[model samples]
Target: MKRMIYSMAIPLSIALSANAQDTIPPDKLYGELFVDVQMNRIFPDGKTFVDCTAKRSPAAIVEDYTKIKKAPTADFSLKKFVEDNFDLPLAPSDNYKTDKNADVQTHIKQLWQVLKRNPDKTVAGSTLLPLPNSYIVPGGRFREVYYWDSYFTMLGLEASGETAMIENLVNNFSWLLSQYGHVPNGNRTYYLSRSQPPFFSLMLDLLAKKSGDKVYAEYQRPLQSEYDYWMDKTAPTKHVVKMPNGDVLNRYYDQYETPRQESYREDVELGAKANEAVKKARYRSLRSAAESGWDFSTRWFADGKNISTIETTNFLPVDLNCLLYHLEITLSKSYKATGDLLRANLYTQIAEKRKTAINKYLFNAADGWYYDYNISGKALSNSMTIAGITPFYFALAPKERIEKAAGIVEKKFLKPGGVVTTLKNSGQQWDAPNGWAPLEWMAIKGLEQYGKNDLAKEIAKRWIDLNVKVYKATGKMMEKYNVENIDATAGGGEYPSQDGFGWTNGVLMQLMKEYPTP
Candidate 1:
């Protein structure tokens, strides 16, 4: 890890830009102690220790640990050692009671406060990276503001007439961009190695809709910085990939080859039988899948079944590229609004080039759906997931292709409650039987963009009904739903389905506004 000093007194922007703060991940901060705690199951969740704040200075703690471990001590308990050395991460409060009698919309509005977090103060040894503005977290185990999740969460904020909160979300992300050159998956030292998705431009677009085009002009540099981070020609393997046809695109990747600090134990056990090289590759795939925001999804798996077979870094995702296309277009418009016509045209040209590459490489004519391009194998992934509709969602698909894609969504992907995430029931949360709010919103908006109102409204209505039903029964919103069997709980991930869900609240409110109950 890079050597540096951290101070609460120093301005964050200056501290980061001047290289005064070391952003070393938690695993390295505690060294072998981190490995021992994780491997020995000292905590049920690997995230526990990583999120803990050291009771003393890190140097002092490590020094003490070295001495203690080396000494002839009897009955050395790893759990006791960890508890003594660190302040445990606080579990999300279960104090908030459910008002099942209230309307779902009213229930959601109340949750905004329950899920909201105020501006943070910097703690010397905590993983939490303080944000300048107050923001909403995804709730449950996720106490920090997430990247892509915020975009969907903001949709609800907008519908709730909480425009100020939306602005705060945008400001916090921009601040992170200024400090770190890119937004991480969330505001934590452990998340620094990867970003969820490039949704900063979309967040700006949401704020602009309320505050006007000047919002884009205000965030121009951060937008460019985000784009540059993803399309860095200097490190092609990190995020960029050149297609066999010579077009450049981005892939989800993390520079770190070690197991994720949050899911360290699970990853290590999964790759335990593998060789060193294979274990490293498994770790990269796992981390890259996290970057895609569909961690452990069959969409990333080579065999379309086991999480152990995931090859996420090998394929260029359709949804990611579509988001980048939107970013490029947004940048072009932002530049044009600011009277920088030269740069505006340049970005427009860049978008056009990407648009061409996407259609050429990602779209499979046989199925009439966009699929991830496997840059490693020089073929289309052929894995049909809800992500296939991303081009249509962005309104980038040709008119002819839109109809066919919509047909596929209606026929194959749609379930009794809503659209399933994928056709394959791979026992993964991002696969069949589970439908996420953000994807439902994307499918609805995308179909509506192509003038397919009936289909769009159907999806909105079904999704809204499912959300309402779940809320009625459980008195809480969920992160994902069992669209195939709404009566059963959503399953198939490392963690349980979280409630106080930010995006579910947002998407439901937005959809309810459009497709009101009869």
Candidate 2:
């Protein structure tokens, strides 16, 4: 029942030796470039400006967003709220002119043609090719605004010398927090009750250092609220809470949407439709907050059996737990940034304790790596990937152990473009051949964090090389790449495995700017 106000610290300048834009104040820096998430938000006719908070609905077959229906203040439905809150308007969701053009897609191809090459500064402090059809609108981008994609896209921005862009990204996300407790997976009718990875804190940390913008502290309260939204859900619950035990819901999932297989039609369609084992788990599974894509997702899935449903079945996923550990530490760091030493220390203690507990309770000594654990605290037997490398970012792994894990990346998970989503190659994307950008950066940074710069640089070179090769071949970039054959096209999940993938574009831009292929 208490509301807390947190002030943001704006550093006069941050030392970013890597890129352009020598110095800029926090307020003047970029966060959100002007976006036209039309169907996403609502605004009344009399008002010249649209309220991002205004809830609305999509119009006839992608009609002009202004033409969409907006709810009055009293009638905001969950659907409207999700759509309006995170909409990305005017984006060319139609990245390819034809199926033949799929391999030729690039972020630029998805934007307004007029703005294609012209550069404009974004709210995140980077220059973006503002597309045409600003107010006029365009064909796609309805779902990108709300998924796991933006995170990796932000990394792309970093690769492309767009530090300022990420700053705006952080700020815009922070602003979203001030307005809404959590950023829904997308601006649509479906994505109301879930979130992707709790990377807001991680992104905030990156933006904080990049912008020397302590404005992150301003976001602390909301950030904490969002965290609480998910973390608190872990509290022991019976009524269909997500957990392997079916008795205890873990901290992530909230509820299920489409029955098990109905959601991941494409992925499962390729494999066996839900088997008895899957059906049992699906009906038994509760879901964590929806992040980017839908269905009881692969986010929680371990060695391919779709562990996302049972709240804690994949209890100690190395990646999920690792990310959680970082979120906690990030909060602790944010606390110190705002000068709350005591509180910061408390959080730090908690984070460290959690790290210790995970290592002690979840790390499979025999397996010599981290894995998901069952209720009895025994590790799940599988080769699934749950982000074993990120712990290096937090100084959690011992040097020897990190090397052991890094070796796994080289031997199994590493893809030419980046690290495959997982080791399974079970056709459940989170498992294989599909190389994602965020994991590329995570692997890169995690290696660097451990002074494994040589290894980091090697992986970076492979990824960047693949990106260049594909760009040269297709004249575009995409949400993911087929690392197995860098020259081949990547298969996408959700509608047609899209291009103009916001997160892909963002990450490429970011990486090109910072960790150039050289």
Candidate 3:
């Protein structure tokens, strides 16, 4: 039996305030335009105008619209108005194309060149916020450098021997940390309120390993700023949980409960169908799940099937805590590098305590799996997902526990193509049948940590095979693969599967280097 119970006493008022802060502002310029266009010209298929809207203030846009309407010519073009007021997000680059005859490695290297983005343009109405250096985008609809996605992308960059670009990416993230106090999920102003997984420490660590340990000291302020952003109690720290034992663990959380600016229509519809009392909570949870980088998974669902039952904020996700544990360890190392042993020891102690608490609360001994602890319910979630293997990736688990987890994963989670995101086929993009690049990498590397080499190789081979098959058939690398039915294209989520796929290219390249074909 797990000794830790979900006995944290969170103030309801604080929770409500946090939710309020996360909700999209009713008077937001683009949000109002989204509702107007969605209601009138553009029906809610979830993509259309929402993706096209300028990230500007609604009141100002409304005033502009009203003035345009009162003009003598009455020739107001919404597109022109948007162009005049805001900078649009990046469109897909025309330079790159898949050559079916080219090998996957060549195609990936070409794609990397095509996906590189320069600093944001210094024009009004532009959605891109300029970074200090150029960076690689994930491709297709994601034309910006995503937070966690960059780390995986960096792995491939390193393998490709593009060390300079890797340093550029690190600088970009550090710039973000200094300017915004934390890295938003992405670079757009719309992403300011929330952050994705805290991987900045890992990013710095990678740079240090390649460059030198002095890199840690150089980036210490931004690293500490990032940590402070997560630990701040007011509004920035959304997912933090206080344990009954007076220790703290983190969870996935977002600031806005309103429909995401990108997925406005879908979020609004889901909110409409939800029970009114829990609607805001549900919406916020959905947004929080997005922050987890596993946007819509059965792991966050109460019923494991529908969107209405999403309660992401109520659970302390195992993967998130594991990442933070690594962050604490990194911080300790960074302080030690700077000759601050007292601060180093403090962070070391913090990491150790968190390790104990995570095992106590999240490890399901009876099932031999690590589950996300449901803070509100005081129990382990039933979902079996690849996230259970993350602790092993970070070498956080004991050898015996890692071996037990490997057995369970091999027996239950491994699929025809690769490891599925979760066991349940819940019609969400992050569920079974859909295998993402990041999770596959995590599972494979985690297995390798425990001498499960054969199993890791098998997973890698199958995943590479699936990637090749899809690329061969479609002439494009995808954001996610249909692991269940290799022949069928992956489906589900707010939109159709995207291409340009930064992490996909990265992980595939890294795996190819690790297990070259004979």
Candidate 4:
């Protein structure tokens, strides 16, 4: 196994001791809070059972996480964990408080009732039960059984002591592989074009521990399909014929293609200092900051068609390539696990080639940063975006390289709370001054791998503290944060962006649990 520096290192401050599955009371709980609590499961190592309930019967209301650990070191109770962490068994809450009669417990019970109905799909958070017809959404469309969000969202869900739900999440990921080539980012249209942070391999790792069934052949097909889609199939053809290099590249998906409010943020920033002669040329070349960064701008230029973000420049991205390298390795393991040495070797060969190509084209030893070279033989070597540090995730760096990169992260990009979106802070939401969930996770984990523990912990804690601060004050989990300036709102991009972003909430929940104070 590849050594993971940041892999599940946090101490379990509130491990579940005892929890039982009882009935959920719909009338007693707030629908949204109810679903949020039942999203994931946590338990003590070795224990017995005490199946119980929260509200009334007919609906699923979980009372425990795992049984008691009749071991030598520690002991816990799931019900106790809920009471201590969530402040349940109190009175009424101001907004879902357990003591204030907010009925988050009750609400969670009701949400699980729905999840139990779908044995294959994993439960999700932020339950919108009995969704009003005002927004006018279809049944399946309204309550999404999202994949990427489920893992992080479960961090909070585990507070209620539900491990089975995490098991279900694993099943859902398996289903995605079983059905589609890979997992879709979310269960909604807006997220259709992309996959959320690549946590599949990790999730599978957890599920394997829980289920103890590492069926490689059953999973090989789906994993293979995902590899082919992003690595091979979806890349743009670009030519009427074939090329000698035997590689096809595609454009990274962008959302600001909406003609209604198109803003070429990338072009605007990169072209800001263009020579007078290249003014028209810059305008045409950039069109939009589609491939680099532009969170909300891509929707305007694509006639409202689906576009994830300015990821990998509408095709292969540095971070994504790094992620794919890991994915390919995992798939190769699957091949080997299935007793197919030949296929495993083939994937291993592909991984080696990719690593070589990345070092050859992306690394700028002179500047001490890695950059994406466009298909037209142009390397985006100037900008100081988080994309440069991605090589760390692939374990592709030595001490000197990572140290130089860390200096850059600290001096230029790392903010008080977390890593900045870009060094430019072009006031574009995706530019400098702003921070995002994915980059924060990537930098923190990668930094930890290289013994940058203090910095990694600081960034992760600051981000989690920010979310808790904002949520307690506003009852909202924002989409992004102004990591550059703690008091000011996030800068750059288009429109006054939404604050209650889905992935943001999920990541915050996950980090808070991962970095509990020692």
Off by over 4 Å in 3: 1-27, 40-61, 67-90, 233-236, 274-277
* CA lDDT of every candidate: 0.85, 0.49, 0.78, 0.48
Among all windows of ten consecutive residues in candidate 1, which has the lowest summed lDDT?
Answer: 1-10
Give the top-scoring candidate (lDDT).
1
lDDT digits (tens) for residues 416-501 of candidate 1: 78899988887788998899998999898999999999999999888888888888888889999999997865988888888988
Q: Which structure is stronger by lDDT: 2 or 3?
A: 3
Off by over 4 Å in 4: 1-162, 173-182, 188-199, 212-217, 233-315, 489-502
Q: Identify the superior model by lDDT, candidate 2 or candidate 4.
A: 2
Candidate 3 per-residue lDDT over residues 253-298, each given as its tens digit: 7776767766766677788866766888987888888888988998
Off by over 4 Å in 1: 1-22, 233-237
Compose the digit string of candidate 4's lDDT tens values, residues 1-518: 21111111111111111111111122122232222233222222100001111333223332222122223235654445444433222111212322233232333333333333243222221111111111111111123444544555454345445556555555555554433334544332223234444556655555555455464444566566556555435322111111236642223443222211123232344445656545443343233232223443321222222232222332245665676667677788889888899999988887776677667666778867776555433544444578777778557765678877887888888787688867653445666667887678778878888888887888898887766555555544455788866765455544454443444644665566578768
TM-score winner: 1
Write one digit per residue (lDDT tens) for candidate 2, span 37-125.
21222322101112121222222112332333342355545344335443323444444443334432344334323222222233332
| Cα distance off (Å), candidate 3, residue 418 | 0.6
Q: Tell how far residue 392 is off in model 1, in angstroms.
A: 0.6
Rank by lDDT, highest first: 1, 3, 2, 4
